[model samples]
Target: MDDGCNQVNPSAALIDLRPVTVLDSITELQTADRHKVAVTGSHGGLASGRHALAHGVAAVIFNDAGVGLNGAGTRSLADLDRWGVPAAVVSHLSARIGDGRDTMRSGVVSACNGTAQALGVRPGHSCLAAVAALRTSAAHAQETDTAGFASASGQVGPHHVVILDSASLIGPDAAGSVAVTGSHGGLPGRRAARALKHPARFAAFNDAGVGKDQAGIARLEVLDSQGVPAVTVRHDSAEIGDGSSTLRSGVVSYANSLAIRSGARAGASLIEVIRRLPE
Candidate 1:
């Protein structure tokens, strides 16, 4: 395997030859990084993979996200192989789920497509190792602002609805408001309180295909412990980076105890669920 497992020495030569881009989210993908290693903190789901492909990244590494719900997480590996893109995923347990730097710093490869394997990238190697091994692969790039979303706020009856492209957009002002975000409902680093820094009246996230151990919906239970109402939209029903799509097209896939008590239920439209929230 040309995985460069033998290259334990951090050579300034190798790093300068093929500088890879590390992104906290694939949403931060830039046009300059095309045809270079793109290591992202995003889930290894097909949606995320497709996003990278659209930008023409050389190779991508993502978190496996517990390989949830029929393997929707990391499903892109197989597809990337078909598309001839070298793709691999790190174990969910290796680092924080949505933080790209963490993924590269400590993430361990859990799987890689045949294309990556053919290039000597494989499971058990560190993400950085995988990055170095595949640096020579043809990379590609695209562009988006670092903020990642055009956030807005409005009212729904007595409740204020804050539509954000990413959960990271939730501000202190949303403490008593409602948040509809395009981010997935996973407990990054398993931090419960970090689910929503603000005590929003209610919140919603994408289900990321409800991957392993139901990790995609893990945020709901964790949010419950914070005494907050939360729900997740089904991944297929909405685009993951468009908060407007989350509201208009998302279907409630799961609800926390507080959400259920507040009239939220699975298999309901998010609009219907929001309408049912108590004043």
Candidate 2:
């Protein structure tokens, strides 16, 4: 037997794989992390699929939201397939939806696109195992001049609508604007009420699969306590990180007391309800 070249435990080779990026939200993707394998806390939707493509990541992972409407939550798989990008999502039940470390630490694969399946990724695989496959994958990153997504601002009736890619972008100056963010409607770490930097006239967030224990919509009640009208659009109904898309097409999935009182009912267009919210 030559020097320990033939290690029996093949897993050792995968233990120290470098160049992977873990993000609580895909919007946090930076230039440094591009072309690397990305594991994020964002949901796998059509818009999110585009965001990942725009960043030119080699591979990506996202969270699968609950009770998808017309397959909105896991629609990214098919979208990625068209671009020859490998993609997959962890089960919302196995990990908190908006926490990336938790997703990588505890998530189990829930779905995969054809490209991922070709690489041996499968349902029930742990997040690490999936990343390992992507690490050694023969897949190449596709580059395009596609402009990266950015926050968009517009108006709805008399409300100044601020559509943000992440709720974390909310700030003191945003106090009176109606905020439509792509951040999950869940509280950060399921405890920290951090989405709002300052009080807004109203806010909307993505209901991240309404995952286990309804962790997805956890922020609604908290916002209501502060007298802020808040609502969550279903993960399936809109992109998880495209604020413009969320505002343009999001349908309400959950609403807090104040929103409900304001006629923010589930299945109604978020823009429609916002028109009636007091300025």
Candidate 3:
């Protein structure tokens, strides 16, 4: 096989480059009809590959397009827009979507804190991470006002790029109040515990199972602890309450993950899943 561009010998035709950081050379080869990229990980160093894509490559492949990706210099989705490249995410967590996901079908936009993750160019994951990598990049950018999300120039300020879970754990020091959407069991329990500590407003969205699970029970505990209130009903049922009064107004929101589980893939999209969140 021939290795794309550099021709050392006939046997060296099959050029296999793994764990490479610089995508300029590879892109040059593919542009010159010397090489082709079949598949790649959505992990760190994806931005380098994006650099190649920006130059007009054939196609790009990604595996873990979820969270914790490190592009070469691209900081967030807005940054990728400047490069004129779209990233495909293969993960579930919300934060991943907030960072690298482009306008592509499988892409997403997520938020995070500057304490955990890092910023890069490509569309995999950022090295920046929060306690659990839950917050989205937009949320992080809003919280810090860092140019990391600046669409003007790549030169941004110094701030943490980590993804945080929810305001339940910490106070409302980050982006606008984040809404939690997931199975109300595992991490929800922990989030509820955190909410009990501070008097912050919140909302929950659970499916049939989650609405009646241990995590749901824990969330109720948090509400009670914080002196908040809640009411749960089947997907079809509706309740009437005053929307104007803060007391009548809810701090926490809940939904059934299984309510409309057909159209969505394994993990539901933020637009679809959390759409019911109070505006």
Candidate 4:
């Protein structure tokens, strides 16, 4: 279904309840004067949850996508808690709700973060119900400033490497550097392609199981088309769900190993691996 966006004013509430097909649509709320609660069709990945939280929403609802490896749902829930905003995830089945707009309006919540639990939102509750609870508990919402938490910086020996937990952290300056990221190798749209095109040295990503759809392979293809050197590491090898696992610690481990095996300099771009010769 085509992604859609809508805003509804719940009765007796001063803020609006927005339903969006993707987490990126949360930007639409930037111009809103009143507080908002977003219901998004996006997976409950660290990047998606962080995007919603950074936008200053009162709460957010996302699809669990089976919670994937490394407990993506659980990590998102923790992230929302740190941001002081209630967050919930509906079943992946709910992702098809009316052009994605209705997913948040009618889907049943499958999990909730700690902040949401404090607001009386529970698993098995309806998305609408969770939003209502958040509205009522808005007064208790903590004042959390996450602007500085979006992207973290680090050094890899002599080269400065940008460490991001998600693909959403990629920016204009990310074009020509060694980047270690926890984002899955799924190039979904033009934005993702553009972001992947910028890494000059090398980019590391999670394989996300390299499922039947072969999304992981597609990401590599797109990067190859753009002439970017990249590699996909097993998500479970490092930490999968939480931001801590997806950061420099995870990326560095894989990058270092790949560099050593490929005879690439420390912090240098990696050479694509060909088939190994039989011993």
Per-prediction tally of clashes: 14, 2, 60, 1
> Candidates' lDDT values, in order?
0.77, 0.79, 0.26, 0.53
Model 2: residues >4 Å from true position, as ranges? Answer: 1-18, 140-142, 147-151, 164-173, 188-193, 225-227, 235-251, 260-269
Runs of candidate 3 exceeding 4 Å displacement: 1-192, 201-226, 230-279
Error of 3 at 96 (Å): 12
**Residue 15 shift from truth in candidate 3, angstroms:** 16
Q: Pick the TM-score winner.
A: 2
- Model 3 Cα lDDT, one tens digit per residue, 144-235: 12221101101112221112122223334423333232212122214445433343223332221222123322444445445443222111
Better of 1 and 4 by lDDT: 1
Candidate 2 lDDT, tens digit per residue, 63-87? 8866265666688889888888889
TM-score of 3: 0.23
- Native-to-model Cα distance after best TM-score fit, residue 228 in candidate 2, in Å: 3.0
**Per-model TM values vs. the true structure:** 0.64, 0.78, 0.23, 0.57
**Candidate 1: deviation at residue 230, Å?**
0.2
Candidate 1's C-alpha lDDT?
0.77
Find the 10 residues in a row with the least total lDDT in model 1.
139-148
The C-alpha stretches of model 1 lying farther than 4 A from their native spots are 1-38, 44-60, 63-130, 137-147
Candidate 4: list runs displaced more than 4 Å.
Answer: 1-22, 25-34, 41-51, 63-73, 78-84, 90-110, 114-143, 147-160, 188-197, 208-218, 240-279
